[model samples]
Structures are given as C-alpha cells and as structure tokens.
Target: MRKPNAARDQLLHDLRNAYEGGASIRTLVASTGRSYGSIHSMLIESGTPLRGRGGPNHRRRVP
Candidate 1:
C-alpha cells in the first residue's frame, strides 16, 4: 500500500479546526466526504481532542 497523502493530513487538520469550532462530525463528514473512522484515526494520530469528551465508555482524557 502507498503512504498516506498530504490531503489526508490537511483534511484532518481542517476537520480538527472545524470540530474545535463547534462543527458536528456528521457535518464534517458530509462536507468532506471522509469516513468517520478515518477522521477518528486522524484525530488520534494528530493528538486532536474529541469534541464531546467524557462519554460513558471514554475514559481517556483529552490532554
């Protein structure tokens, strides 16, 4: 498999910014046409905090 492109990284950064600015995941996904899993993984890799943290199953703090 080829390495991930800069588009993915840039998309992740844009998604992170949109998310932090109060945009919903659904909105971002719809607008960007990116998968939720990909977005989630990007956030994980980029160390971006989840918009809604502290859910029932989420114990990992966003720090």
Candidate 2:
C-alpha cells in the first residue's frame, strides 16, 4: 500500500511535469490512476492554472 504523504507528493510532482508538458487532464487520469474530479481538484489546490474548455476558436465552431 502507498503512504498518503508520499503519494500526494508524487502526485504533485507528476501533475507539474504533466501539466507543463501539455498533457491533458484525461491523459493525467490515465497515467496517474486518478479520477477526473480528483485531478481537477488537485490542480486547483496546487494553484496550477486551469486550461480553458476548448482550443482557441472552439467557441466559434458550429454545434
């Protein structure tokens, strides 16, 4: 079993690298074995800037 603090540290480290490396939340979920909500929450808790819902001109796209 993983220790709680160690796991949290590792998660933070991975989150920084992955987020800076342009890995999407879905990708982080697949790699970190964490849920989408968990990852999103952690990102917020860590003060990591959240990306917008879509790409640059996504809002301009037709439904």
Candidate 3:
C-alpha cells in the first residue's frame, strides 16, 4: 500500500493531467475513485479553472 502523502500526490498528478486533457468532472470522479466534491475542491485548490456546467457538447438552455 502507498503512503498517504504519496497516494495524494499521485491523485493530484492524475487529476491535473486528466483535467488538462479535457476530462470532465464525472470522468475524473469515475477514474480517480474520488468524490465529486473532493475532486472539485482539489481542482479549485490547484488553480484549475472549473468548466461550466454541462460538458463540451452541452448547449445553453434557450431562455
């Protein structure tokens, strides 16, 4: 088993790479085995700009 710090660091690295590569939060959560809130917070703490609601193909609702 990996140490706590090492595991965290690996998670961060994976998260950064996945996010930068355009992976969605859902995707990250699935792949990382992390909670949505946790992933969201990590991204925020890492200075990663959060993507707007919906995904790449998501269209804004017509008013």
For candidate 3, the per-residue lDDT at 30 reads 91
lDDT of 3 by residue, 1-63 (tens): 745687777777778778989999888999878899999988876678777776378667888
Residue pairs in clash, model 1 = none
- TM-score of the candidate numbered 2? 0.70
Q: 1 or 3: which has the higher TM-score?
A: 3
Kindly report which residue stretches of model 1 are placed more than 4 angstroms away from their true locations once superposed: 1-5, 53-63
lDDT of 1 at 23: 79
Q: How accurate is candidate 2 locally (lDDT)?
A: 0.82
Ranking under TM-score, best-scoring first? Answer: 2, 3, 1
Per-candidate RMSD, Å? 7.6, 4.6, 5.0
Off by over 4 Å in 3: 1-6, 55-63
Q: How would you encode candidate 1's per-residue C-alpha lDDT over 1-63 as one tens digit per residue?
A: 759889977877887888888877777778878887877776777787786643488566988
* TM-score of each predicted structure versus truth: 0.61, 0.70, 0.66
lDDT of 2 by residue, 1-63 (tens): 855697787778779678878999999999878899999988886778888876675555668
Between candidates 1 and 3, the lDDT winner? 3
Clashes of 3: 0
lDDT of 1 at 7: 90
- C-alpha displacement of 1 in model 3, angstroms? 24
Candidates in order have lDDT scores of 0.76, 0.82, 0.82
